[model samples]
Target: MLYNNITELIGNTPILRISPEVHKLKNIELYAKLEFYNPFGSVKDRIAYGMIKEDLKDIKENGKTIIESSSGNTAKALQILAHINGITFKTVTNRIKIPEVKNILRILGTDIEELPGLSECPDPTDPNDPIRFIENMVSQEPHKYYHTAQYSNMKNRDTHYKTTGREIYEDIGTVDYFLGTLGTTGSSRGIIEYLTEKNPHLVKVGIIADKGDTIPGIRNVDEMHEVGIYEKTLYDDIITVNSLEAINGMETLIRQSGVLGGPTSGGAFWGTLKYLEEVDKSLSEKKTAVFVVCDRVEPYISYIQKRRPDFFEVETHKDTIRNLSNEELANVNTISIGEALEWVEENNPLIIDLRGNMAFRTSHIPNSINITDNYFEELIDAGIPFSNNILVMLVCPVGEKSNKFVALMKKKGFDAYSLEGGIVSWRDAGYPMKPLNLKKKEQAVI
Candidate 1:
């Protein structure tokens, strides 16, 4: 279809049904709103288009360039939207995002601002730090720049309320549960607010980052992205799933439904499945569950193919980590840093530092082994135990990488826990460390 403006392509994404085999147990109908069908190949297209249009409406008297912070998909969508409207686009993103996204941004002539350190924030509570960085750029360059502020932008939620929510309600009419990921909380909050107003019985379920407590129902302090203040108060219920569940779910979508979606979208789909199973057992009549297939998985093709070659080959393994209280991990399981330190001293649990080789070599917990030198296969081939009996604490400079690796190991049938603060926190806590010794001495130049 031809469109005169990007705003014209804001909504009306197609919805597809999940196969009967995929929904065998629940016996309830499952549908995914294929949001990738949007102009930018992601659901963020609606928000990017809507926010720009709204910003333009109020500021028609003045010209403004668009700016925002995004990991990948959102940035791409905004860039495409801004370009079509003849507005200059600038994006502040971390260097750790997928290379394909960076390539797209560069090709779109986006003035790229790269943030120092990890791409995703480690602390969700400190939302201002990232926004401040973006604000600094806007201050220095006053050339008609407006920040989209996805994390805290009410417009993001408004877009979904006006477009996506209406489309779903029109298509399904009676959706018992509205499920989606909690990246910015815009989609969930918008849909929940709109649908709940129409039908108070509609339940909104949100899937949050497993490392942190961004989700209302789950609690963790680890840093991860979440919807901003304006977007937080829209959900009825929330669920948290770790990287393993997300990855497995992504693989399942490809295998079962031929729907290749990103890890976050897969988590949403999995959460929806669990919700359906629960509601089915309780209710006498069949209920409908709908989720947004936020984006296509093509961008992650290289990373997943390289990291998880056997991901699709294996059958879905039952998750072994029981849902335990924080006290359990701290007291009974003894995985907390303080307790783990004691066990490290007494039992010498195999500590594999998952951080970069330089970070691992610079300083680490005493007696900790460095596994970053080789790939996972080499480490496993070199006699690393693959059983859950072994106590393994994956360590990094910070906790994010370690958390991701620990999740992968757990999926491979290993008992793994991430060091809370990674090596940085360990060093700050006055823990003992040894620096790598250099073999060659450098001479001073005049």
Candidate 2:
């Protein structure tokens, strides 16, 4: 395993066969592509080096900074590679939800330019898209920066095809099914395209997070369309897994198979099992399936603790939104855009916007005060911030977060309602929105 340089250790990661006793699949042999074994500790290492290796000499000689839109592994790998080769690396992204990932990037000397966009996936409509920002920067001074646009770059997929796909085929020939969490869609696209040539019947299943849910390194179903590398036709089926399901799946993999993978890996595993269970019932022959273990879980400790505080023996409030029962969630009061408009005029309810301050300053419902969802949760932890007498309304990007909060509020005896379809619906309904214009000094204070 000796190598002259770390880049030499980028690919050829081992694939582990899951024990039948663990997965409990009667007719299928399930395997996990243990991609975390890569030198940079994730599947992205292959592409990180692939994207820059050919151009490394030119980039170094020209003194061009390596830049990309990445919040996690890709950024980490590129930064390390850039440093080792005497090239500056910059990460422009809005998807850094995990604090540890951001801190790790900073520790690696990554020049992080964080934008205020909320979605982990690209939003073509969003003015602050990281890819769009990078494109603008490169266009203005092309020689100064080398933009490795992972989402759109063919190199992202080509590298995976040449290495990852080839490695898998060599280890386990003619994979019947390939399941992978869709981030840049590079790995899935490259792997499936390669595998399909070997086995025409190979089922390619793409995993995504549920709508309005966050799973680090993967896009939600609603956001998938905005990704340039994503092709709906490429996947035989698409599956959605939630944050809780992802963690649960990760735990199962860790305890049962000793695969120390992250949430994205867990999501792929969860989706794979869910899809295969039904297929197994009708199968007569031996079939093989593979899912990717994208990265290790150490970086997501805070993310895990926030969702499952009881794991750490921390005291959790009974009325927390995450703890809401199915019945409570189903009963959350929600008002449609038309109904909300008339209701607002008559009831004069206290409107609370749960989006970030930057988004709030851009545009929000008139007279609604921005609290940001995290701070709003803290206020609830302390006790009722408002009297039960006043009618209240909760707002968010979509209806999801507001719906969950409203469920908890109802449990606490608050007369609250969530705006159906949230602020997006209100905007589409042509309701007037107010934008707060803050001076430079006031912006700094905020």
Which one is best on lDDT? 2
Per-residue accuracy of model 2 over 1-446 as CA lDDT, tens digit each: 57999998889899999999988899999989999999989999999999999999999999999999999999999999999999999999887878899899888878999987354322222456678789999999999999999998899899988889989999988899899899999999999889888999999998999876789998887777768888889988888999989999998999888999988888888989999999999999999999999999999999898777788999866777766899999999999888888999999988988776567777878778877677687788898677987799988877888998899988988999999988888888999886775653222111
Model 1 clash pairs are 65-144, 122-223, 123-223, 184-227
Q: Give the CA lDDT, 0 to 100, for residue 119 in model 1.
A: 22
- The segments of candidate 1 whose C-alpha lies over 4 angstroms from its true place after superposition are 25-27, 57-63, 119-129, 140-143, 212-221, 224-226, 229-233, 311-446
Candidate 2 worst ten-residue window by lDDT: 437-446
**What is the Cα-based lDDT of residue 428 in candidate 1?**
72
In model 2, which regions exceed 4 Å deviation?
A: 117-126, 382-384, 439-446
Q: Candidate 2, 211: how far from true, in Å?
A: 1.1
The lDDT per prediction is: 0.65, 0.86
- lDDT per residue as tens, model 1, 307-388: 4555557442232222333443443222556765675777667777654434445565766665552254345434454567
Whole-structure CA lDDT of model 2: 0.86
RMSD to true structure for each model, in Å: 7.2, 2.5
